[model samples]
Structure formats: structure tokens, C-alpha cells
Target: MKEAQKIFSRPRSLRNISTHYCGGCGHGIAHRLVAEIVDELGIRERVIAVAPVGCAVIAYDYWDFDCSEAAHGRALAVATGIKRVRPQNIVFTYQGDGDLAAIGTSETIHAANRGENVTVIFINNAIYGMTGGQMAPTTLLGQRTATTPAGRQIGVHGAPLKISEMLALLPAVKYIERVSLHSPQEVLKAKSAIKRAFQSQIDNLGFSMVEVLSACPTYWDMPPKKALDWIRDVMSKEFPLGRIK
Candidate 1:
């Protein structure tokens, strides 16, 4: 008999086409994890993803399922509508720091507050990767960005928003977890958190979200490996990992 396959190939829920994400960017990993969960749960056919306006706005091109585009910071609103009308569908929204935490904070908070039965895959890369490395709500203190050339200052930029923790206080939010992709161990943990988030939806639980601390190497002006190290050494301090609920 042929030797057992060492490892499985890419999930069928993900297309074979190349992505436009930068080298070492965590969006690809996030996409693969979501696709893997969808495939494993046999929900690829029922999955409906809301692709918001950001770095992942074109995510529909990579995922092999029904996907719709939402205006800037409006992904949660659109997803709420879709899930409300098609309660049977597995609805999820993929959003980045700028799109979700900055412009879409109100929608996200309200959705969780209402306990919407949908999953949200939040990519928190600290800086806005798509829009010229500008400062985002999640950008760490002292973090440099195109908009914060002198480094983030509390007097002007205010404090970085701990969105996961803020959302965890909502009564309707059934589950909330913050994870990172800095190392292999962290990646595994992140995947596990993502799986649980999806399972929460499958069980018809209230709002569930998995905030992934992703890296933006190209925008951060560092090599991919160094960017991962920064996430582990510096970024995690501002946004600690683990379940909020």
C-alpha cells in the first residue's frame, strides 16, 4: 500500500489562484484557516462570507463559496442582514483593523450586543496595511505609521482600542477570543480558536468572534520573520492572547 499522505493539501473551500497579499502577510494564513474550518464542518456549500472594504475586500476571489462585498466599515451590517434573512446560512464577515475597528466599530459592537448568530473573523494587524500603513484604532502605542510619523502619541491619537475585550462585555456575545500567528504554536492555537468560533455558530449560539493578531511585513518595513517576532515580543503585550469569554 502507498505510504500514508504526510499532510493534506489545501482545503477545497479555497481556490487555487494566487493571492495579492504581501509576502509574510497574515491574511493568507487567516483565509486558509477559515477555509479549512468551513471544509471540515461540511459547510462550504452553506457558507456566506461578507468581504468588507479593506485589504481583504477581494477575498471572494480566493474563497470558493458565496461572498458579498460591503462598503467601508459596513460588513457587519450587511452580514447581519444576510443572516437575518437566510437564517439557515452560515454567515461570517472577514475584516481588517481599519475596516472593522476604526470605521465599523459601532456596527461590530451593536451586532455583538444583539447576539447575532454569525461569526466574525477579525484581522488585527495593528496598522492599516492596505491604506498606506496609516494609524488604525488597534495600532499600538508608540507604533509608527504613515499617519503617525512621530509614533503614536496618547495626547493626540488616544489609546489603542482593545476591541475584543470591549466586545466581551456585551451580554449577547457568546464567545470572544484573541489569537496570534507569530509562531507555529501560536498558529495552531489561533486555528483552534477559529474552529471554536465557527462551531459556536453551528450550534446556533450567539455572536462569536476570533480576533487574529496578524502581521503586515511590507507595510511595517521589515522582513517577514522579523515582523512575526515583533508580534510575539511587542504587539502581544498590548493585545494579549486567549479567550475573552
Candidate 2:
């Protein structure tokens, strides 16, 4: 019998350990994508990640590279400062919807507007996963969340924020893509988008962001497989997936 070749292995940029995110959570996949990009670019040693308050706040524990914990909604600002001082290094911010689209809106917009040489990995799972499944800024309209037991009413909760489009309007932003991980094909596309976002910064092109439509199974109260289906069938309707810029 012929020996089978190993098809895959964990990227060296990721620590050889399990993550804390709940089963079916997309943060783990996002982390692996970032690690794979860092490894592929051979910049693991020079990569600095800014992890903000959210589900990924403990990302430093998973990634092998240096990481700084930033306050909620301050990831972009912190990454901006880090990239400015360490121009030789690659700086990226890993932020969730609540942290990025809500509290960090100003920081994120200004950073992209300023054309900061940084990469932003925005995970838009719609509802905030870490803090009791609250309705986040990106939470879809008419979608039920912990805070919106009756489903999100536009009149009361307002329309869902389209952050990627808003950021693409900034002149300094060189790249903006919205991808999802609801299926194998989408995951591949998401990985490609992430690589391009990192490459843009490496080339000093300007601010780049790849908004990933991730799944929050626990909060969504669905199994891992069902959550993915929801992302494809329902969630994607509100936040369409594509390259915004």
C-alpha cells in the first residue's frame, strides 16, 4: 500500500493549541486565515496584531506572533500607532462587529481615510457574540437577537450599518472586500481576500479591510451546520458578499 501524503497542517504562525471560541464560531477560522497569510508572506516575525475587546480579545494566546490587547473600539487607532512607529512591521487589527462597526467607527473611518498602512480583519457575525448576543451595529434588520426579542424593528433599532461601504468611500482605503465562510467555496474566497488585504499593506498600498461574514452559532441558537446555512440563506441578504472596493 502507498503511504498517503499529509494534506494539511496547522500554520506555524498559530500556536499548537485549541481556541476558546465556541464550536462553530468563525473566529477560529479567521485566526487560521490570518496565520496562514502571515506564514505564506514569511512575515511571521514582523507581524503585530492588535486584538480588541470581544470574542477575539484573547487572540494573542493563539497566534504565535506579537500581539497587543487594545481597548474596545480602539483596535484601529492602536494598530495605526503601531504601524506608524514600526513601519517595517506588518500590523493588523482583528475586530468583531460590536467593537469595529459600533464603538470603533470613528477610529476605523479615520484610519482608513488617513491611508494608514494597516490591515483590518473585520468579522461581521451580525450579532455580538461575546457579550450576551446583543444586537450589534451590523445586526440585520428584523433579525432577532438577545436584546431584540421581538426581532429588530427598524423604527426602534434603526437600520443595520453598512460599514464596508462606508469605509470604501474613504479615499485612502486601497482595498475592501466582504467575504463569508458559510461554505467551502466561500471559505476559500475569504482566504484569498485576506491574503490580498495583507499583501496591500506589505506593498504599502494603504489601508485594507476584509470583512468576513462569520457565524455565531451559540448566540444564533443553532448547531454549527445550521448556523452556516443561516449565514448563506438569511444573513447574506442584508450584508451582501463582494468586493466593496
Candidate 3:
């Protein structure tokens, strides 16, 4: 029998740790994608990952690159400080919907407005994951969650927050795109978009964002497969995964 060639299938700059996210949670996929990108781009040593509160807050624990923890909803601020002080280092903020589109709205907007040379991986899972399933700003109308048990009512909850569209209008933004991780193909696209965001920053292009429409099966109270269906058939209608503006 011929000896098989040794194949390196894992990332060189990655750490092994049991993730805290529940089964079918999209954080793992996105995290792996980010790690793969960092390794492939050979920037792990010079990259700074800013982890924010929410489900991905402990992300620093799994990444081998230099990482810093940001207060709840202040990832953009932390990333800005790091990128500005050390422009040579690639800075990226990993944030969830609750942290990015809600409480950190001002920080996000201002960072883009200032053309901050940093990458932001904004994960939009619709409902808040860490602190139970609250209706997040990106929560789709008529979607049922813990807080909006009777389904989100447009009259009371108002319209869903269209963040990417809002941000694209700003002149400071260099690259803006939205992608989903609901399937294998889309996940690849998401990784590509994310890689582009980091590359944009590396090229001194300011304010690049790749918003990922991720799934939260536990919070959605659905099976893993059904959760994906919801994202594909229902959520996509509202959020429309693509490069907006």
C-alpha cells in the first residue's frame, strides 16, 4: 500500500476549544471562516480581533491571534482605538446584532462616518442570543420571539432596522456587503466577503463591513434544518442577503 501524503487540513494559527455556542449556531461557522481567512492571508501575527459582548464575546478564547475584549456594544470603539494607534495591525470587530445594530448604533455609525480603517464582521441573527431571545433591532416583522411572543407587530415594534442600507449612504464606507451562512455555497460567499473586508482594511480602504445573516436555532425554538428554512424562505425576504448600496 502506498503511504498517503500528509495533509494539513487544519489552520496553523488556530486554537482548539469547545465552543460555547449551541448546536447549529452560526457563530462557529463564521468563526472558522474568519480563522481560515486570517491563516490563508498570513496576517494572524499582525491581526487584532476585537471581541464584543453577546454570544461571540468569548471569541477571543478560541482565536490564536492577538485579541482584545470590548465592553457590551462597544466593539467598534475598541477596534477604532486599536487600528488608529497601530495602523499596521489589521483590526476587526466581531459583533452580534444586539451589540452592533442596537446599543452600538452610534458607535457603528460614527466609525463609518469617520472612515475608520478597520473591518467589522457584523452578525445579524435577528434575535438576541445570549440573554434569551429578545426581539433585536433586526428582528423581522411578524417573527415570534421571547419578547414578541405573539409575533413582532409592525405597529408596536415598528419596522426592522435596515443597517447596511443606512450605512452604505455614508461616504466614508469603502466596502459594504451582506451574505448568509444558511448553506454551503452561501457560506463560501460569506467567507469571501469577510476576506474582502479585511483586505480592504489592509489596503487602507476605510470602513468595510460584511453583514452575515446567521441562524440561531435555539433562540428561534426550531430544529436546525427548519431554522435554515426560515432564514432562506422567510428572513431572506426581509433582510435580502446581498451587497446593498
TM-scores for all candidates: the values are 0.98, 0.98, 0.97
Alpha-carbon RMSD of each model? 1.0, 0.9, 1.3
Residue 12, candidate 1: alpha-carbon lDDT: 92
* lDDT tens per residue, model 3, 1-245: 99999775656555877898999999998999999999989998899999989999899888888999999889999999998899899999999999999999999999999999999999999999999999999999888899999999988998899889999999999999999988999999998999988898889979999999999999999999899888899988898888764
**Model 3 CA lDDT for position 86:** 95
> How would you encode candidate 1's per-residue C-alpha lDDT over 1-245 as one tens digit per residue?
99897597899999999999998999999999999999889998899999988899899999999999999999999999999999999999999989989999999999989999999999999988887899999888898899998899999999999999999988999999999999989988999999999899989998999999999998788999999999999999999898899
Question: Residue 157 deviation, candidate 1, in Å?
Answer: 0.6
Question: Model 3: residues >4 Å from true position, as ranges?
Answer: 5-8
Q: What is the lDDT of residue 113 in candidate 1?
A: 93
Error of 3 at 207 (Å): 0.6
Query: Counting only residues 3 or more apart in sequence or on different chains, how many pairs clash (N, Cα, C under 3 Å) in candidate 3?
Result: 0
lDDT of each: 0.93, 0.93, 0.91
